[model samples]
Target chain A: MLADGLRRALTLLLRGDPEVLGIAALSIRVALVATLLACLIGVPIGFAIGTTRFRGRRTALTVLNTMLAFPTVLVGLLVWLLLARSGPLGGLGLLYTWWAIVLAEIVLAAPIAAALTAAAVQGIDPRVRRTALTLGAPAWRVHWVVAREVRFALLSAVVVSFGRVLAEVGAAMIVGGNIRHQTRTLTTAVALATSQGDFSLAIALGLVLLALALTVNVLLHMLQGRGDAGAA
Target chain B: MLALRDVTHEYLGRVVADIPALDLPAGTTTALVGPNGSGKSTVLRLLAAVEAPSRGVLELHGRAVRSSAERLHARRAVTLVEQHPLLFDMTVAANLTDALRLRGARRVDGRQISEALELVGAGSLAARPARALSGGEAQRVAIARALLLAPQVLLLDEPLSAADRAAREALGNVLAALRDRGTVVCLSSHVLEEAYRWSSRIFTLVDGRLEGMTPENLFRVDLPPGTGSREVRVGPLRFSIVTDRSGPAIIAVPPEDILVSRTPLDSSALNQFPGRLTAISEDGHGRIRLAVDVGVELITRITPASLSRLELQVGTGVVLSFKAVAVRVF
Candidate 1:
């Protein structure tokens, strides 16, 4: 049965089945948008929190670190309640739509980005900032020097966050509804297929998901290697 | 001139530097000579405007800087190379280019970057990555990065505290060039005689207090009106003076000027004292510092060879002699 499922999955992939390609494309697209939004909102927040000294910063970091380990299903359940009918945001009626799934993944990815970025910024040497200040750099330019010094680590944070959100199914399944040919992501389709005892399509979708995760990990290692070289 | 008036700074609620008045004039290479923890680096930071004074003013060209904008302007006019300088994560050439860009250079000239690196004998390391540099190479590159800005004042903290003989000679050439170029260089050093070779204006600091302008051996003397002899009593000894002012005065005998001998010699050179060597310590840079008491405490630095030749120890009684002309009154 496994061999037959694998052979059938490869054939479907090679034939470019519209259903399979559409699901894969939607998965990549939704996750890409979510990851970009997370980075846009989280990098600056993390940099500020990491560099500045203020009251309650320790509490903020503690909350952020806790959010990094929050269950994905819990994030999905919270989004479900917020988007459910008669909920606070129910007026928008975004439940079980592409936007709903994107929002869920965004909620999932942002904290990862923020927490890792803060760690990266904190790991750098303060002398780099002082040296730039002495070189006639204005405050903003000094900030740029610090960011540039840790650019590799920042990229690693982005990749790590992207990897986390891409592999997560609970949030997308709860918020996207797995609608046929519209919101059916690879993971949701695999779940739907496996429940009906269709192992071929489920295995095919699992293979695709595994390949993508492998790619993300490889990219992460490559980025870390370059960062170490630059810091050497 | 770059001036600091009533500028005092505190670190973590403890006073680290207190400068009543300091004037680092253009065309002068001033040296802040002191031992460890003497607040030399703190004074340099205040002069560079990188650290605001706890209660005082920093003046650029005789105008007091009052606001943040003016403080930034003051910082732009001066550049400081920290004692342990950190280079940006880039090639040597790129670091200089970034500094030029930081100073608002719209068009970064490659020739100018190369020239700055070459100025500090670091031209060969222009293409080398910053992380790959040795200690001396990194020091040279950091200084080169600062020199690229060509600010009116260049403050260096402990520039010679870590260099070897060859690096020292090369850095000496760089300092000599800056002196002739009239860039208003101010640096700190434990070795005073080396500072004298660069500039005459020296500010000595001891325990965070400005002890007039000498590396060591500063004495507050009372110059009472006397007969025809040009001499003043300090402690249990008398020293000849060149200045005619006859009131309380501060006198400094440069450490290099005093010659140590086993016994008093019959020579034309005038002032001499018999004293016991109280302490002996090494500055970790091939120089020995000695403290002696001839009814008053005095400090001097000499080489290892001289120490070995004189056979000096903690309790040895020796004679200290210097010409009357060597005593500086402030």
Candidate 2:
């Protein structure tokens, strides 16, 4: 039975089955949007935390680090409450949609993005800032220069955040409702097919998900290698 | 003038730098000479406005550098090159251009960038990646970046620490040229000869205190009671100066007044000793500086012609003579 399921799964993936392809595309689209949004919101915060000295900086970093490991289901539950009927944001009517999944994924990924970014910025040599400032660069430009210096680390943050949201099932299931041709992602489809004992579809979607992650990481590695060589 | 008034810097409750007062004027170069951990870099940082003094005030052009607006204004005219320079992870040309842009240059002239690199003897490194440059190359690049801004005041912390011989000579020429351009320059070095050669005025820091700027060899000597004149002993050598000052006092001897000879001379000079020539090096100019071990080491400056005429080389035995009146007791 297992052998038959494996053969059927391979055939489905090779044939580019519409249902499987749609789920994979939706998964990538949602994760990409979420990761982009997280980067936009998190990079500056991380830069400020990593480069400046202020009151309560340690506490802020601790909070960010703790948020990095927040359970995705809890994030989904919390986001669900915010978008539920009679909830404060219910008037927007975004629940049970791809937008809702995007929101949950952002919440799941932003902290990781921020914490990793902070670590990367902190890893840069402190003299870089001094040199920039001595050259008459303002405070903001100093941070910007430092960010450019550690571009490789920022790329890693993007890759890690994207992978986190792509493989997340509990949040997308809770908030996205797995609507056919809309909210159903590779991870959710895998969950739904396995529960119904459709092992062939489940295995096919799982393989695609793994392949997507591998492709993204491999591309990033190539880019990072190029950057390293150019720097050298 | 750039001045520090009652400045004291403390790091985590431990005092690191304490300067009662200092005045640095324009169109002159001052050297801060001291050993490691002697708070030389701290003084440079304070002058650069990279850090604020924990106590007292730092003034630039008669305005306090404590406020953000004042500091911003001061930074436009002041630049510092750190001991271990960190260049941006970009091409050397880009580093120069970036600094120019930050200094509010409307157009980053490639000619100017190349000239600045040439000034530091790193013109060939313009296309190389900054991160790939060696320590000496990066140091030159950092100096070039600072020079591109044309700051009115340049502060350097061991600028020649990593420079090669050629780069060091190039930098010395650059500094001399800057003086002619009316830029006030201050640099710190642990090498006393380098400091004495490069700076018209030298401030010696011992345990974070400025020991005044006197163009003389300084030796801390103990003065014990004597029958006629006060006898001051430094190492195995003793000199009787015409002074009544008791206890420990600093003795300053003018380097130019000290004469070196192959034989002991019959003269009125009160101080004479037989010593070995430990080292001979050129003082930035054509003059040669000899490190003679006369009980305590004494630095004597002479022309290269005299050095050759005297036939002095390393380890050559010589007689050093100086008049007691030439010694300034403080």
Q: What is the TM-score of chain B alone in each candidate?
A: 0.67, 0.69
Instruction: List the DockQ of the predictions in order.
Output: 0.50, 0.43
lDDT of 2 by residue, B127-177 (tens): 998988888888889888888888999998898788789778888878977
By TM-score, the best candidate is 2
DockQ of prediction 1? 0.50
Candidate 1 lDDT for residue A143 = 81
Local accuracy of candidate 2 as per-residue lDDT tens digits, A151-213: 887887888889889999999999999999989999999999999999999999999998988
Model 1 C-alpha lDDT per residue in residues B79-99, reported as the tens digit of each score = 998888888777889888888
Q: Which ten residues in a row have the lowest lDDT in candidate 2 chain B?
A: B222-231
**Candidate 2 TM-score, C-alpha based:** 0.80
Q: What is the interface RMSD of each candidate, in Å?
A: 1.2, 1.6
